[model samples]
Every structure is written in structure tokens, then in C-alpha cells.
Target: MALIGRILFVALFLGSGFAHITQAEAMGGYAASKGVPQAKLATFASGVLIVIGALMVLLGIWLDLGALLLVIFLLPTAFLMHAFWKETDPQAKQLEMIQFQKDLALAGGALLIFALYSGYGDNLGITITGPLF
Candidate 1:
């Protein structure tokens, strides 16, 4: 059970991180479309943050730090990309708000995981006995 949970956590984080890296250009364009200042910079920063976050998550060394970084990175993304100046159409605005809330939830989850288990240990266990004398 624990192993499965750990694997799920790692997979989730790794996938999210990879998305940022793989879609940096698209992300940048989207940011620019949203009227964000320095869209290119935002895109590059996203890629870097995602890569670092993915590494930490996969390596399980300093995952807390990675998760925290993810939270920081995602907060603005959630707001600027999904929340800010919602669509005029009520339905569209509601949809955007829903997406924004989802992103916020994801960010909060990452933060919680980081805070709870950052450096204590992996969510899994691997033990080996000492050689017999």
C-alpha cells in the first residue's frame, strides 16, 4: 500500500514537472497571450522549476524543497493563468474559476506533502540486513 502510494506520488509529480519542460514554448505563448510581462522569462522559469521539482521528486532527496518550489511556481500560474480577469461569459468564467481552484488545490497538496515529509524519509521502505559474522 505504502509502495503504491509512493509510486503514485512520484509519478504525479514527475509527470507535472515534465509537462512544464516539454511544453515550455506553448506555456510561454500562453503566458504572453494572457498579457503576462516577460512571457519568455516566465516560460523559461517554468521549465527550470519543473525540471528541478521533478528531479527532487524522483530522487526523493529534498522533495520538500521541490514541492515548496512547485507551490510557489504554481500559485502565480493558477492565478494569472486561470483566475485573473475571468471571462465575461458566466459559464466560461465559472469554468475558468473551476480550473483555477483545481490548480490551487494541486499547489496546496504539494505544499502539504513537502511540509509533512520533506526530509524525513521516503514513503517507501527498503531494508537490508547486515552480513552475518
Candidate 2:
């Protein structure tokens, strides 16, 4: 069940990670609109981070660190990209709000995964490198 949960959790990031890279130019434009500095580079780098982090978590290799990486990615993204409070347009605000909430939830999930692995990793299931503290 834990293994299945891990897989289901990472499924969200796996495709998104690749999309971030492939759509860096487009994503960069969006990021730029959100005032992200060096948008293209940041987008590409984030893609790399997501890919590596998702893979690590999925494989149970240093799961805590991988989950931390996701948390790192998620928090800033939630604030920067989905600043719904700053949106004047009702529709835009609603959309951003949804995204913001979603990121926050995902971040929470990642944190929970981090805590689980950090505390009781060995008891979970199969892992390539286990949880490297």
C-alpha cells in the first residue's frame, strides 16, 4: 500500500517534470509574466529538480531528500506563480487560487512522505538506497 501510494504520489510529478523541460520556453514566458527572474533557466532547472526528485522518491532512493526537493519547489511556486491575492480579475483570481491551493496540498503530501520516510523508512518497502539521512 505504501509502495502504491508512493507511485501514485510521484505520478503527478513524473509527467509534469518532463513537461517543464520540454515546454521551458512557454513555461518561461508564464514564469516571466509572474516576475520570475531568469525565467527560462529557472524553468529548465526546476524541471531537472522535479525529474530527479520524483525519480528518487519513486525509487525510494534518499526519499526524504527527494521529498524535500519537492517541498522546496512547491512552496515558492505557490507564492510566486499563484499569487491569487494579487489578481484583480475574478476569473484569474479563482484560477490562481485553485492552483495555489493545489500546490500547497501537494507540498503537504510531500512533507508527510518526507516525515514518513525519515522516521520509518526501513519498514516501508523495497528501496534502492533506502532513506539516506
Candidate 3:
């Protein structure tokens, strides 16, 4: 079920990454509202990162690098985009907290995947080029 697991894991990212690019103007506006600097460019760049990372993981090539890219995107996004602590409204705070927690969890999953591929060697999937490490 390794392939199935990988597919499930990347599902969220593929859709989100596509949206970030295809709807950059709208997503950028949302990012701007959240105080992201250079929102449009950042949104586009983030989309690229997400898509590339997702593809790498899905294809079982350079898995470690793919996981790292995901971690890189997720951590800061959790802090910046979903700053629950900054939300004064109870409902808004709750929503942000959920999003923040989700991001953290996803980041953790990515790290776990990285550790598995990097430590155990690329025996987990198709492994086109193998882990970069």
C-alpha cells in the first residue's frame, strides 16, 4: 500500500498547489490580507514549491528532498498564514488554530517520510532516482 499511501498524502498538496497558481490573484489577495509580503509572487512561488515537492514524493524520486520541500513550505505557513494567536475573535481563533495544527501535522508527516526514506534507504516505493541523501 506504499503507493496508495503516497498518493493519499500528496492529494491535498496537488489540489492546493494547482489552486495557488491557477487562482493566484484571488489567493494572493487572501495572502495579502494575512500580511504576506509580495503576496502574489509568494503565492506563485509557494505553488511551485508545493507542486514540485508533491510530484517528487509521488514519483518516489529524491524522496528526502521532496519531504524537505514540504516541511519548508509548511512550517512558516503554519506560523505566518495561520497565526491563531493573532486572532482575537473566538471563531476566527478556532479556525486559525485548526489550520495551524493541520499544517504542523502535515509537516510532521513529511519529516517522518523523510526519515523513512533517508534512514531506511529507498525501499519504500518505485524510487526512480532514489533519495537524494
Candidate 4:
């Protein structure tokens, strides 16, 4: 189970990183649409961030560092892309805000994993005493 969990975690991060890399241009356009300046730069930074974060998470090297980076990256994503801006229509703003909350939740999960496993073994101390009778 621990092995499966770790593999899943690695796969998730890698997939997300690849998405950022592959879709950077589209992401930049979206950022521009949302009023972020230097949208291309922002997209490039985001791609780098995702790739580095995914690598750290997969390698389990400085998990806290990866978690912190992810948190920082998500902040702008949530605020700039998902904020309930006055310019946004009510319904769209509501939807975006919800998505922002979800992103925050994912960030929180990463933080939790970092907190729990940053200094622990590869399995993060998951254990089972015995199988059910």
C-alpha cells in the first residue's frame, strides 16, 4: 500500500508538471486574459516551478522545499486566475472562487505530506501491525 501511494504521488506530480510544460503558451494566454502582466514570463515561471516541484516530490529530496514552492506557486494561481474580481460576472466569479478553494486544498495536502514525511522514511511511517482475521 505504501508503495502504491508513493507511486501514485510521483505519477500525479509528474503528470501535472508535464501539463504545465506542454501547455505553457495556453497558460500564458490565460494569465493575460486574467490581467497578469508579462504573461509569457509568468507561464514560464509556472512551468519551471511545476517541474522542479514535481521532481523534488518524486525524489523525496527536501519535501518541505517542494511543498513551499508549490504553495507559493498556487498563491498567484489562486489569486490572479481564480479571485472573485469585480470585473468578473457573479456566476463566473463564484465558479472561479470555488476552483481557487480546491487549489488551496491541494496545496494544503502537499503541505500535510511535507509536514508528515519531510524527515521520515520513504514510506512516511505508514504501518500495519497485522492482517485482519
C-alpha local distance difference test of each model: 0.66, 0.93, 0.92, 0.68
TM-scores of the models, in the order given:
0.74, 0.97, 0.97, 0.75
lDDT of 3 at 92: 98
Writing each residue's lDDT as its tens digit, candidate 1 over 53-85 gives 656654555666766777887788788888635
The residue-by-residue lDDT of candidate 2 on 1-133, one tens digit each, is 8888989999989898998999999999999999999999999999999999999898989999999999999999999999999999999999999999999999999999999898998588777776877
When summed lDDT is taken over every stretch of 10 residues in candidate 3, the lowest stretch is 120-129
Candidate 2 accuracy as lDDT:
0.93
Model 4, runs deviating above 4 Å? 1-3, 9-12, 85-88, 119-133
What digit string (tens of lDDT, one per residue) describes model 3 on residues 23-87? Answer: 99999999999999999999999999999999999988888899899999999999999999999
What TM-score does structure 4 among the candidates reach?
0.75
What lDDT score goes with residue 114 in model 3?
92
lDDT of 1: 0.66
The runs of at least 3 residues in candidate 3 whose Cα sits more than 4 Å from the true structure, single-residue gaps closed, are: none
Candidate 2, which segments miss by more than 4 Å at Cα? none
CA error at residue 98 for candidate 1, angstroms: 2.3
Better of 1 and 4 by lDDT: 4
